[model samples]
Target: MSALMLDPASGSSVGLLVAGLIVLVGAVVQGSIGYGLNLLAGPLLALIDPALVPVPVLMIACVQAALAVVREHKHTEWRGVGWAMVGRLPGNVLGVLAVASLPLAQFNIVIGVSVLVCVGLSMLSLKLSPTRPGLVVAGAASGAFGTASSIGGPPIALLYQHSTGPVVRATLGAYFLLASISSVVTLLIAGQVRVEHLSAAAVLLPFMLAGFAASGPLRKFLRGPRLRYAVLGVAAASAMFLILRNLF
Candidate 1:
């Protein structure tokens, strides 16, 4: 975890600029298509410090999830959301514990592999419907990855990919909101939720809100195929980046 901590010196103006760009762009994509911020931000931030990756990313996720759920409240699938919460909460506790003891590099490797494998299966036509078992699995996986790397959307996204627009957005928004809430609790229990970091996340909140505002027009214009392809491309690249980083 120490290896993942942010270096104060590395938080230069240029680094902050780059991080801000990531937040802006990632937030737009997330706001437009229902998710992608951490997928895009985590690996990019990892280049600065892997230890630093989880907290800021989680912070942003907290904000993103809240906004998303607020925006898409009407279409949420109550059954799936309820079961997902049940499975995720305990798993999040386990994952937070892992964060204290597990190496970031190793966790990255595992999460990277999991993302690649899940995405590949989706690409291979293995449908991940939001059934009871699938929801449970996705929830548990989301909880673990959310705690471990602040990148919890892939498993849940895979499930929602084939769903209708409203269903997908509502399902994902709800899942993320709940999982993030649980992850925050776990982080607090683990004493990893720092006040300073929360302050930093607060400062970035406006950027996320701005991005969401900017995305409103674009969301109506973008079709499903275009959005999915864009998301898949980014997610695949991030997964590969994680794998290669671990390998070297």
Candidate 2:
């Protein structure tokens, strides 16, 4: 409570309300498509209050993923998920290393540029299939990028661009479920998980769930090829967002 800068009488802060709205919007977007929560919410939340980020946001993401998994679990590619998680393990370590040792701006530039290049490459003949090796590679890349930049969906989302909407959402939900849990656990081990984090997350969960509920209607409109374009657009936008974020 004190950590959130809440008013004792009201039991909340204006910044927190603003953050909940942002999370709601991000959640709706992510629920309709397969990703975009972090891309949409991370910056805005940081501007509102830096403490709203990372821990609390990640907690909501984990819950959102869990709900998504339940929502479309049947469409998930279980085999691909297993392989991707395997790759994610090592990739997560690499991301930690890069974050600790590399120059922030330069490293972010490379990551952002690489994501953009990958988007461009997808337009060519380098389409990724859901084979074990492809999934593993994509998963590893996602892990590294996500760990390094807190934006992991592009790699996995790109791999599943050609898949059906349900497949894309469900598979990503599963991947994020495992990955988010892993990340939170890691943070806990590092003593980054605190009471304030849980407080913030609790405050935001309702809004997040509301956004997910609102997204049910939007999903119908994003079916088929439209969903692919949406994913690609979100991915490209996130890449640019990352580049711009670090440059300034």
Candidate 3:
């Protein structure tokens, strides 16, 4: 195991350790505030190893979403999630095609810029009600982005930013639970899911669980406006990171 954990930065046996710590922190954020594991972990993990993006991080996200759903089951908004998923199916198909055919570097730049622009719009009081149509649009966007980059929570999170904490967490959790399944299936069909992806996820699972365990104590401090700001801040920073990494 030590031989396998070579650090890309220090050339020490701590690459997996660093990745696990990142996952742990991201998981705590996601568990406490709902929706940030991918945004926080995806780019950093990609720096550690490009192959770790989208699939392995997504697998962990699926688990996190599932755990969130179980923890917040009573607050789940089925109607909104249903409509979003209705749009997600087709969007997921399109995303798979994009991943298969498009140039990843260009797509990364486009996605990064798009996320930053959306985050900026959100900060400017761009709010969307969680109506059926709005949910469908958000869901479709989430499916496309998630399938391509594994960072799909921002759109849905933005849509529900003004909602109560439990609702936001529960709805997004349920939505991600379903969406992650769709993404994995699509990736499997696109020949993207491999044993190594599962292996990486396994390696990171303990840290994810640990972070989630820690979140139980931190949830009290991150309510209402605090939660909203945390989501937006993380989203903006993650988008900026993606843009800089791709462009430079």
Best candidate (score: lDDT): 3
lDDT per residue as tens, model 3, 1-248: 22223223335447788899999999998888788899889888888777787888888888989999999899999999999999888889878888888987787778778777877888887775788888898888888888998888887888888888888888889999999999999899888887777777888888999998898877778888898888788878887887888888
RMSD of 1: 2.8
Cα lDDT tens digits, model 2, 143-174, are 77776556777888888889988998999999
Runs of candidate 1 with Cα error greater than 4 angstroms are 1-11, 49-51
> Which residue pairs does candidate 3 place in steric collision?
none
Model 1's alpha-carbon lDDT is 0.74
How would you order the candidates by lDDT, starting with the best? 3, 2, 1
Root-mean-square deviation per candidate = 2.8, 2.5, 3.2
Candidate with better lDDT, 2 vs 3? 3
Residue 38, model 1: lDDT of: 83
Write the candidate numbers in order of decreasing TM-score. Answer: 3, 2, 1
Model 2 alpha-carbon miss at residue 221, Å: 1.3
Residue 232's lDDT within candidate 2 is 83
Give the Å shift of residue 131 in candidate 3: 1.4
Worst 10 residues of 2 by lDDT: 1-10
- For candidate 1, write residues 85-106 as lDDT tens digits: 8879877976887788888779
Per-candidate TM equals 0.88, 0.90, 0.92
Off by over 4 Å in 2: 1-12
What's the lDDT for all of these models? 0.74, 0.80, 0.84
